[model samples]
Target: MRLPCILVLFLGCGSPDQVQPEIKQLNEIPLNIRDKTEVDERTATVNDTLPEGWVDVKSLIPELVLDIRYATSDNFVGIQLYPCERCLLRKEVAEAIAVAFEALRADNLGLKLFDCYRPRSVQEALWRKVPDARYVTNPAKGSMHNRGAAVDLTLIDQNGHEIDMGTEYDFFGEKAYHTFTKLPAEVLTARRKLRDLMQEVGFKHIRTEWWHYSYQIKNYEVSDFRWPCPGQAL
Candidate 1:
């Protein structure tokens, strides 16, 4: 969904109270991800570092709050699919996210990333579990994420709490739609805040997921490799 989101009305969600919590962590994966070394020999990326033209978002924004869901059992698959929690985006995309995050900082806000730069092998694993193209992108055709051009993220406040956007991240269905307006004004405002900032930085939103964005300005080839986990052998 890297294409620019259709223009949304922003409502100065600078105040956390504006995006009040409707359902606390509903369908949300609690943030408990920690560093680990548990690569699946069958699917782990065989590389020792990020591939060329790729950069870990943390390198650009050390304070990046990465809740890489697939790295833990909290995701839809209910399994730890990644050996470690990392946010690898193409260099340009990573830069764009950094710029967006810095822009939000003036408002005392931040972006919490959920997913980024998924490996093709990981995409296949997701496809294996949820073959529905409507939910999981077909590994055959490839997702923009598979090409390191997409990200799943949400907005956060100064205290590092998620700004309620009505539903939680990765919650599929009608309520997740970008146009699903049957929501509190603040929630709509919060969603618009995220869309506007991301779009300003050249990211696009999908109609169904407020947290998903793509880096359509530039494209990269799909990769089967993963970033090597710390303490994992070469």
Candidate 2:
């Protein structure tokens, strides 16, 4: 379903260049903890030990491939948003994704992740660059990615070639919408297979983006913690 424009605007109001100052102000705003149970239930307590309930997808499902476009300048923004090319997701969501990967494996296929678990700060940077609700979600409300409950992904064949999905990942147009038909039969079939597998494992597809899906069984808090990058001094 389409997110309400008013909500998008209300939550994501500033421009990209203004992100630093806005982030400073946002930090002053305390998290609402009245729903402590909700936070406790969904928030993964991460530590150096690689705690339970939150995991790096690559480690858990080695066969699943990662493109992690945000880690490079190939994305629409033309800026490297992530310091590393790691796919982090809540434990349950990661497990469900693993299940989907196994399902695809039966057909000699695998899953390729484009994006996952985006930091809230990066969301602000994206807002500053795009500033359009049509393409990017407002950082104020936080997206499912920020919650570690969503993923942008596609399917790959046994040879590791990407299957056609009508359009490339992050294509900002109607052609990328799941409802936009008018494509080759193979492309449509590929999209259907991906959607069916994701839904079967409890992920919900957004109508506007064929590659995007959010886990439906649980909720999570928006997080600003950035993953550590390689070569950084401890």
Q: How does each model score on lDDT?
A: 0.74, 0.74
Q: How many clashes does each candidate structure show, in the order listed? A: 2, 1
Worst 10 residues of 1 by lDDT: 24-33
lDDT of 2 at 31: 26
Candidate 1 stretches with Cα past 4 Å from truth are: 1-48, 232-234
Summarize candidate 2's per-residue lDDT along 152-209 as a digit string, tens digits: 9999999999999999999989898876778898887788778666766777777778
Query: TM-score: which candidate is best?
Result: 1
Residues 140-211 of candidate 1 have per-residue lDDT tens digits of 999999988999999999999999999988887879887688899888888887876766666767777878
Clashing residue pairs, backbone N/CA/C < 3 A, model 1: 2-214, 45-226
Off by over 4 Å in 2: 1-52, 230-234
Q: Model 1, residue 118: displacement in angstroms?
A: 0.7
Whole-model alpha-carbon lDDT for candidate 1? 0.74
Evaluated against the true structure, the overall lDDT of model 2 is 0.74
